[model samples]
Target: MTYELTRDRVEHYFDRTATKVWERLTSDAPVSRIRETVRKGRAQMRDKLLSALPADLNGVRVLDAGCGAGQMTHELAMRGADVVAVDISPSLVKIAADRLPNTLKPRVTFASGDMLSADHGAFDHVIAMDSLIYYTEDDIRRALDNLGARTSGSVAFTVAPRTPLLMGMWYAGKAFPKSDRSPTMIPHGPSRLRKTVSDIGQLNDLGRVNSGFYISQALEFRP
Candidate 1:
């Protein structure tokens, strides 16, 4: 099935799978080999993102752009940072909001909107997580510019790396029956992404996590 990358479709895709997405990110027990691989890769990505954060986040202002289900949002808040979490899917935002602990409620504000257009105000740091995979190269650049403009410290994000093997796997996954692939899973190269953020900050290649056929790269931009 050919999947069209439309706003409505993207929202629908995530909205219906918000719970599953949350489980995939937070689950510790894997029922199958595929699940284990996915869990390990996601954990590595989350670790890389967290490691890039400042050593001291007490009272820090953070923007969790495209914070689907708010896993990182919760983590940041737990570290004593006030977090403004935003997502394009209303259901996902709701899921994130509901998942927050009562004490952390005051530290987090959940908003439903596109990160590229949302005015989340200034923040000490910003994290986009696995969100940029849904955007085109030009749009990703614009999003990076917007995020950079609102942060004083750094901006961290993950992307589906563009490589012959990964590109082939992406296509194969799309061609499979009943595939749960996102319509906007466009792969990007690290060099091209660096050029896009060149004017905003200095790019640091954090590293990459391999999950069988797929690879997710983590990058940080210091202003």
Candidate 2:
């Protein structure tokens, strides 16, 4: 199920798909309204990070790793924290800047680059919402280690339940079917997800919800 990893092909597929998702999730319309659709979802995302957040993060630097469109990144800043928003795609970074409120823009530092490579070590918190799904188990292990290195207190990330069928679709979606290149890969079930998370390190499973079969949201953190 390997598809050509051409830059144009990869970027084109993600740019369109991400835009569609962004519209659906952020729209003010009735049916597509994310806030209405997922009651308490925002609190849930906030809670995951809050559970392990140190008591002294008011002025701490935060890294919004893989901050697509800056939705969650904005939320981080709204909480009175300094945020360094980052994404692999230039287009997403641009959109994030545009989406930000003019007043809050000063608090956000948007950078376009790989989260694993970015010098985010100065930050106190590192958040990977709906990210960290792209790598294989080995890759995920390495990424977690890297993220932990840069994090001052804890590292928070979300992973999807991965299965054989889902894994195939994930790869195809990346190369052929052209799905969003996020929530890249994860365990297909809750048990496997828990095991994977725990095996890497002591992680508190924040809980799980139906966030689309291809990308279920289950927050895990090492504190």
Candidate 3:
């Protein structure tokens, strides 16, 4: 599928189907054991993504692409980075803006749009956690190309690594009715992804995190 088509599906899934559940899942509210594991996994992934960046972020400009509910975005601003947190879901973006601490407001600009939009301008770094997992490898590379062009430092992103467990889950989830399914994650082989971005920049294997059903590999690209 083309990027725009995939983006439309993603937007519809997040905005119409999963917004409330996603908001709850990302919050402190009680959830089922399965969902709790997902929450834990996401937290680990966030930390892994953040650890790739510099310790001191004062005066730094960062892009929080697909900044769902703004957890990572808040963290970046807390560390003193000027953040433009963009997401495909307007509902989630609103929640992110509303949930942001007042003190951090001056450091963040929240918007509901394509994360790769050039209007958001340049950045010192970019973090795209759980954002590019749905795209094909080619689309992911295209996204990195656009993001890398605007970033002076590096871009940290995540992908749903193709593994036995994840592949099984993907197949099982396929049994669900189309009406009930959320946006499906396109699992990627690490080597293929790494090699595909060869000309974009220097790619680093940052490591992977697995917490129950949530599994993702983190990578950093420096230009």
Q: In angstroms, how far off is 99's CA in candidate 1?
A: 1.9
lDDT (tens digit, per residue) of candidate 2 on 96-176: 888889878878899986777746556677888765655455556667767766776667777655656666876676685
lDDT of each: 0.78, 0.63, 0.92
Judging by lDDT, tell me the better candidate of 1 and 3.
3
lDDT of 1 at 177: 61
- Residue 135 in model 3: shift from native, Å? 0.5
Candidate 1, residue 18: CA error in Å? 5.9
C-alpha RMSD for every candidate: 3.3, 4.7, 1.2
**Over 4 Å off in model 1, which ranges?**
1-7, 17-25, 28-31, 173-181
Clashing pairs in 3: none
lDDT of 1 at 58: 89
lDDT of 1 by residue, 1-223 (tens): 1222455556777777555755455544454676667667876787789899976688899989878877888889888998999987887788788878999999999999766564678989888888877667777777677777778888899889887886886788768663456554778898988887787678889999988634789988776
lDDT of 3 by residue, 39-81 (tens): 9999998999899889889999999999999899989999999
Candidate 1: Cα lDDT at 147: 76
lDDT of 3 at 221: 81
Order of candidate numbers by lDDT, starting with the best: 3, 1, 2
